[model samples]
Target chain A: MNSFQLEVNIMQIKVLYFARIKEAVNYSSEDVDLPEDIETITALKHWLSKRGEVWANLFSGKLVVRAAINHNLVDDLATFEDGDEVAFFPPVTGG
Target chain B: MIRVQTDDFDMAQVLDDLRKHNPKVGAIVSFVGLVRDINDSAEVTTLTLEHYPEMTQKALQAIVDQAKQRWDIIDAVVIHRVGTLLPTDQIVLVAISSAHRQAAFSACEFVMDYLKTQAPFWKKETNSQGARWVEAKASDDEAQARWTQ
Candidate 1:
């Protein structure tokens, strides 16, 4: 394949959910195609908020939300590329 | 090390594994968290736990690493079970091995505190009335936040 075709075929993003967030979203993870400029965690949150009301409520207000990119905690400025695992959930209560 | 699995683990087996070949290990502290039969006012019969696989393991490892950095712990293990579990069943196990009891105890508690407020797991309880997802407890968060400062 040519370089242009290769670029077009690249997978862009993946969003993973845990606990109640998974149930609310009705998915464990999903691959998404996003524009190149959409790289930060905050931008991804805004894009996902458009998916439905559940997304809006889950991401809305002053809820304490935690996120990880490629299995590491990241701030809103964290960047991602194709095939990176991005996860979101409310504050955890494991123990 | 950390493990996230659906199957229950043997407490004796884990303890033995922690002390098997290590002679310098003078202390081993463990915390076993069981599925409770009550939540708030509800009578809970069972609980279903869910977690983000990659993130859960990574977050756990990070917590363990932090404990090692802050203490003199020789080894640590954290095992959290997912899926449906009955009351009194073990849901999580944290073990810390160190040359001193203080490090062992403190590290074990630190890991639990971090897990309670930072690790990505949720609990849903089912009883005769209905099934409900447990909400985050403010007290638990407060318990964890105190350690940060």
Candidate 2:
């Protein structure tokens, strides 16, 4: 096994999908083992887009997705750590 | 106070509670958002509200905190209801109290404007045609922006 591939399962992060993004992806939340090179929010978006066509549209800016780390909003360049909780959703519409 | 729940809230009781807590308050401004029967040029029957549960409360508190810092408000109360709701159902209530009416009114508006654009809750309306997610408006962003200027 490639050493880099072996490191993949070591870091686990929780990803939450909300609202429209949840309906499109058919998942409310999931646990994803980070790929060795997927370290930042932008990198994670690009990597997840490769999953398939629907995933691509959801993450490739077709939907204006927002990200948050541990309940706080963060920009695309924000880095992730093991066990971090990340959320993605469209812009809010509540008052 | 920030609350997210499925139970319908009593606006009268909520305001009375605020008044009780701050006896010195001279003014209270409250805004109640209701599920409307018409939306986006369609006749709506029911509305569903969804949110990131953990983040929703945190975001609301942060908005209230910002309002507190920006105005001479005594306190803020925010209650948002989720799950299935019918037309005319109360969806949210934002109330602020202060020593003066000017402070109360301004802070109330500031909290509401920020909540419209910043809170994590999303609303979906079901009309005769079907259900659709409420789209974010450029006008909402503009509403939030005016506070800074």
Candidate 3:
């Protein structure tokens, strides 16, 4: 009966929070369980928003939040692979 | 060269190291960003700069590479400081060396302009009133747009 499973799926992704986002979340990083319905960066945010009020408030304004996948800036439409590193941060203010 | 560190940098030393044995460099242009005492009319007392480590290095390298591709500069150096800093402290440096002044000047400005808009660094200013994160201004975007084709 166990042989009926045809594939193994990644159950989690590494998530990083930086700068203001880090302060807001009160943690720098975490291992986020990849929800069965989450397939894209936008979906990932929607999943994270369910974590708590702080997360909901932070992700609710998606316009101000910027994302990077595997160290490169990415749009919401970007796809994520299992074990990929995803970072969420506010817009840069450095020179 | 692109560097991100918490220590202060010596401008003269960086400029000297840039042109070292290369006599082809006839002109050197540089710009330094300093921590100001006032921002958005707040009496800023201190400034803290934060960056995304590996991502910051990559972004800065990409910026300098773009400048090199667009200009005929001999070499460029970017040194940015992080962590806590006081007013009037040096925060960043952009220097370019070239056989002529125009190329060096243009490339140096180009790198700094891109750094302001594209680099993954965040600045928080602590004024007498309170601590606040600095907002990215539209003027910075306009400054970078001027160089685009």
TM-score of each: 0.86, 0.94, 0.91
Name the best candidate (by DockQ).
2
Candidate 1 falls in which docking quality class? medium
The weakest ten consecutive residues by lDDT in model 3 chain A span A1-10
Arranged by lDDT with the best first, the candidates are 2, 3, 1
Across B79-148, the per-residue lDDT of candidate 3 in tens digits comes to 9999999999999999999999999999999998889988889999997778888888889988999998
Q: Flag regions of model 2 displaced more than 4 Å.
A: A2-4, A7-10
> Where does the lowest 10-residue lDDT sum fall in candidate 1 chain A?
A4-13
Predicted complexes: DockQ each: 0.61, 0.83, 0.73
lDDT of 1 at B129: 87
- lDDT tens readout by residue for model 1, B23-109: 999999999999888774367888988787767887898899999999999999999999999988999999999999999999999
- Residue range B1-149, candidate 2, lDDT tens digits: 88999999998988898898667988889999998888763789988999888888889999999988889999789999999999889999999889899998998888888989888889898877888999999998999999999
Highest lDDT, which number? 2
lDDT (Cα, tens digit) per residue for candidate 1, span A10-38: 44777888777787889888888887767
- List per-model TM-scores for chain B: 0.97, 0.96, 0.97
Candidate 1: lDDT of A49?
Answer: 81
| lDDT, each prediction | 0.85, 0.89, 0.87
Listed per model in order, the count of residue pairs whose N, CA or C atoms clash below 3 Å is 0, 0, 0
Interface root-mean-square deviation (Å) of every model: 1.4, 0.8, 1.0
